[model samples]
Target: MLGRVLEEIEVNVLASQAWELYRTLQLAKFIGEELPNVIEKIDVIQGDGGVGTILNIIFPPGTPGFSSYKEKFTKVDDKKRVKETEVVEGGYLDFGFSLFRVRLEIIEKGEESCITGSTIEYEVKEDAAAATNANASSMVSIQPLVMIMEAASNYLMNLKNNKNKM
Candidate 1:
């Protein structure tokens, strides 16, 4: 059976800012720089941070049930603040999934807040559906990403606040 999952998190940040961060690869760069404990590094394997861009994400040591993975951008819409990426190598490919794709969208709630929505779609190999389903279920829990986004939002807001104070 094909497995599909979708999740979303609301953030106290602007949609334009979130879209810029996703489209320009600044989000990955920021996480790699500020949250080494969560993500060790992010390397661009190809493309220019747009559709068809390939990225290698390395998880920090001791990160449970995860390591490095390669993902290719399938779609990126700046106007809509949406991005779709597929795990072409590593990650769940080792878990019997024949296909794995993730879509992220940032929807504006107001001038200062937005929603980060993520959709996960995958297909499991025959005879391995059960195990793959279990694994995919765990992967669908995107708490790490939410945490990273929250940290980044707070950092940027604080920076802006400090500048205003100055």
Candidate 2:
């Protein structure tokens, strides 16, 4: 079975400003610091923040049946303000999912505003028994992505507001 989920949030900042953070490893660091409950830690396994970079993302302990996953940056396009990462080890793959990928895009809305869109694509092993296949499909959710988007939006908005006060 194949599945996908998408979520987007408008950020009160220039697309370039948002891209500056999204296109680098700083986003992972921000998540670790700002949303430790969602992600406990992120270790760079290889490469820089660009394409081919690999990250070991560890979920907080006690996160039902999930511990960590290794994901590789398959695509990072600064010109288009888009980035993509694929889970190459563990993670949803351990839950009978054959593939899991995430894509994030920043779309300009106005001179000082933009939208951050996140997408998750996954495929379950077809040969898996019916029960496993069913369980894998149920595991796909956009809630986590939604939380990230919300946090990013709030962070960016606060940043812009603070600058305006200066």
RMSD per candidate (Å) reads: 2.5, 1.3
List pairs with backbone clashes in candidate 1. none
RMSD of 1: 2.5
Residue range 104-160, candidate 2, lDDT tens digits: 999999988899999999988876637553667567787878898898888888888
Per-residue alpha-carbon lDDT of model 1 for 26-145, expressed as tens digits?
877888988898889999999888889999999998887669889999998887888899998988787777888878788999988888777778887776766444645555556676
Q: What is candidate 2's local distance difference test score?
A: 0.89
Instruction: Report the number of the highest-TM-score candidate.
Output: 2
Candidate 1 achieves a global lDDT of 0.79
Worst 10 residues of 1 by lDDT: 131-140
Q: Deviation in angstroms for 112 in model 1?
A: 3.0
